[model samples]
Target: MNMHSIPGRSDAEGYLFTRRAAWFAYAMTIALMLMDYIDRQVIVSLFPYMKKEWNLSDAQLGSLVSIVSLTVALGALPVALFADRVSRVRSIAAMAAVWSAATLSCMFTRSYGALLAARGMVGLGEAGYGSVGAALIASHFPNRLRGALLAGFFACASVGSVLGVLLGGVIAAKWGWQAAFGVVGIPGLVLAIAYLLVRDYKTVRLTPVLERATESSTNAARHIIKALTRPRTMLWVCIGGAAQLVVVSAVWAWMPSFLNRMHGVAPDQAAKQAALIVLCGALGSVVWGAVADRAGRRRPAGKLYAMALMSVASLGILAYAFGPGAALGGSTQFLIIAAGSFIMTCTVGPVSAIVIDVVHPAVRATGAAVLALFQNLFGLALGPVLAGALSDTFGLQAALTWTPAFALVAAGAFVLAARTYAADMGRAAEAPTETNHLPLGAARA
Candidate 1:
């Protein structure tokens, strides 16, 4: 079916999908996204084993986690720029293959350097997927549904995290760490094929006025740059989402270890427990997205407010997870932590939806890219490394205690984000008629 074709619909409504096509798109996108999370989290679950095998320090372990984020940041803008010029579908499919192969290569790595190289390759592949995938979804789904669909896409992260850790932990326990890498990495190849099987939609042309204005050499570039450099975009990109990522990266990257150390659980058990946490978090993504979308319909700024509440709830949960004199222990601690993780993750769906809502369609990819850049650069790179350092300096428990502080910061950022919603919507409504027809490369202008 021509998924983008909807009779008598305006560009504002974008594509109209058959129910089957929409579900297919959602499923395929979710699967692709799930693999992305699984591959990333697999390494995290294997950290304890990797450390034991390599005789690595906490610092080195932190490097292993941060390296991927560092590489992703390096590649994000370039790949996003490339996506604008090329086929986003093909780019995403190719990325799926590239990262899957890189992940599998980890099974053969003997040293930290080799492992890091493989992880970096994974980052390169993921950068393309992260920026391009979101753009494609934004284009395919109607504006009204974008937040919910994106939320659904991001929800897969929870599933991937759960599977990555639980399965990796199990495989590592029974066979070896290499087996864990192989098991987690190999499935993505199949997923790549599934991605290829999905049909690609043609690029939607922007409105004529945008096309004409963008035809001017200076106009296109200026517009794109202006879009990229917008204060609203930058604020959320750098401070809001990035701060949350810091919290997320640190928690996901190290939570398994925290579980093991605090509760004296085996690696396999810890992995299973962590998986449960991720599963709950994944569910939160869907629930929050729906809530945000519905709420935003009534109150335009409701999405940000939802995020703020999630952040606050996350802080409380983190405290409960680490708080002193609590009666909870063993599986109870795991259950509480899992619940908390889910509540925190709930914010992700709404936050991303709101970001897309505020941007022009032509520059959507750039908006996504800028957000990805900040999220990885500050959120992924700094969060885990800083947490590790703090762990070394104070104690693991103490370091973990500080992790939730970022959530509080994230809450403030979301509140600030709310301030821009009405203004952004107003700008979008008043956007030039020709804004949509501009070439992808001219989007920033």
Candidate 2:
């Protein structure tokens, strides 16, 4: 049965987009997201090639991966602010074009400096994409399905990472590393063109109650600040989410290298093994996101509670897998690592949903950007470099073993965030509703 044909719980609330239109938008946004991560992560599998060619240090190799997240962190807020006020569809299309172009540019760069600059451009283009895409998906879909939908949306990143790793290794082995960029880069350009067909909701007008106050630049800044930061839930969630990604990003970035060094697996085969772990993480994201939503059905804080437990479980499983499990045979160790990978992505969906739940509808994208800013800067940006530096001193195995411990910090942060979740959600409920959305286009089959 077509789920779009049935009325979702929020249908009575009158979502502006038709169910079919909503699904279409969701599909496009998710596809672009998949491409976003593919371009960002395809470099991981190419690390061996780059290292061999340039004779780069481990930290430098990690920096190539880290630079994208760093630029994304620096750029997410301003891009998201612009996206909130303008057209999400147009902004997303522009972003896709920029990143895809950057990805393609990677093929032509001969020096380390040139490649690093190109990678920075990729991050610049992707900076606000996750937040903006989340806002678009949230607005189009009904409330009840938001968690599952958003979870699936973010899960594409893992899938992309999987494909990126697999393709980069295979393509590099067959042709060269440069060809991997060319191969992955083309699809994003095509998808960017295709994305134009997705319908967008009318920009929501600010309510009259605070309209006069926002007329002043100072007051507008204050209003925006309050909207994004007033929620304690946002603070803790941001920290927790970033901390969790430290674990996730490190594992994802280095798993291929780890397998090669530890088990003496070839680059292409190691990437395939690493890709399996990423695929499991992607599956875990969707599964756990749905589980969080189901747990939250009655209690508002249930999502946080569930995530906290999973965070701790992931920490334990991964710590052991990388540390002691390495002593086990290769097959045994890979199975354990994959299990840990599956459990670690539990918070991917709910964190975004929680951020959206606490902020006004008008600043939903910006709210999500705050989370992205944290995740990108402190989580994704730091993870690879931190692990790389560690690997330089101790070894790749030590870096992987120690990195998963950050999940403990994530668990604690989530537990603290839960305390204020109910109250924060209630406050969000009282914010003025956006009734006058400027429709950009009509829905089409």
Candidate 3:
């Protein structure tokens, strides 16, 4: 169906397809997203095992995670831009299959170089998945549910992440680490093929070029630039999203290790504990996303405010959970860490909705890709390496203690985004004119 054909404001009710079809598509998208994270994260739980087997350093271990983010950052834009032009679903499915196969390859690799290359391939496969999948979901659902739906969508990462770590740790410790890769990879491969059975939405690219020239418009270049450079688009969604991720990525990547080395927990035990903390993050995503959606109904700035508060508050909690000066017991620290994780993840949904609220529908995947690029480069790529480097210098504990502070920086960016949010959102609300083609600003994705 032409999902964007409805004449009213961009929202769930405006779905050109039936509610059931939209939801079915959403279910498939989210399930595949789950598989994506499972493949992306399963290696993390096997870190200690691989490190010992290869005599690798902590920094090398960190590279395994960082490499995925790096490749994703590099691949996001081009692939998503391509999907915007051709087909998002097929692109996502194909990418998912590639990553899953790469994940399976890890099970057979004998050397570190081969495994590293495999991880890079997995990252390449994952690069455009988030942006394109999110675009797919956004196209199916309405704008009002954007926050919660995207939150629920993003929360799948948390769930898959938890399973990857938990299942990898348990399976590896019992059966062998190689088995962990296959367990996670197989499901993703199956799901990728299953995704092809879902339907596609027909959305004509909305651009300002003349009707006669629209068929072969060079205006796509200009519109892409405008989409990427919009005020709120540049300042808030991409940058602010990256800022919050610094803490999120660092904590997720490092939390299991922290519990293992510092607290005298076994690898499997640490993975379980870490998984619980991440599970809290998943819960926080839905709760915070729902809160953002409700508050946004009253004031458009509510999502930004919600994000800012979550970042700042989570920072304070993380300090107590990780800092050396604290008098809290180990059990208390775990609980506090879980609380902090839950609050920190609240930003996931709002940042997504905000970008969609501002960018044009024609390039929504590109917008999502831009956000993913910054998020990976700034947050995922930098956060872990920075922590690992700090650990190499001072200690892992010191690095963990300091990493949560990035949330303060993120909170500041959210406040800045709020400043221009109203104006930007107002601009996005004006639907495209059917008679005369208007500028990109008038076309909300």
* Candidate with best TM-score: 2
lDDT of 1 by residue, 1-445 (tens): 1122322233433554444555676677778888887887887677788878898766677777787788877776556555555566677778888888998899999988898888889888887565466656655667678778875665566667778778878888998988877777777788777776654555545455655444444554466567755548336634777787777777777877887777777888888877777777778767777876877787887777877777888888877776651366666766777777777666665655566667765566455555666777888888878888888788677777778788888888888878888788677656663434333321110
Off by over 4 Å in 1: 1-30, 87-90, 131-154, 190-223, 228-238, 290-306, 325-328, 437-445
lDDT of 2 by residue, 1-445 (tens): 0112222233555454577888889889999998998898888888877778888877888898899999988776556556656788898999999999999999999998999999999999987787778777877776678878976876677778888888888888898999989999999999998888987655555456444423443554465576677889999999999999998889999988888888988888888888998889888987999999999999989889999999999989999999999889999999999999998989887898898888766566446656777888899899999999998999889988898889989999999999999998898888786432111110000
lDDT of 1: 0.70
Q: Model 3: how large is the Cα RMSD against the reference?
A: 5.0
Runs with alpha carbons beyond 4 Å of true place in candidate 3: 6-28, 84-90, 131-154, 194-222, 291-306, 325-327, 359-365, 430-445
lDDT by residue for model 3 (367-428), tens: 55556667888888887777777777887787878888888888888888888888877776
RMSD, every candidate, angstroms:
5.1, 5.6, 5.0
Error of 2 at 248 (Å): 0.4
Please identify which of the two predictions, 1 or 2, would achieve the higher TM-score against the true structure: 2
- The lDDT, on a scale of 0 to 1, for candidate 2 is 0.81
The lowest-lDDT stretch of 10 consecutive residues in candidate 2 is 436-445
TM-score of each: 0.80, 0.82, 0.82
Go through the candidates in order and give each one's C-alpha lDDT: 0.70, 0.81, 0.74
Candidate 3 pairs with clashing backbones? 11-142, 11-143, 12-142, 361-445
Question: Would you list the clashing residue pairs of candidate 2?
Answer: 202-437, 202-438, 202-439
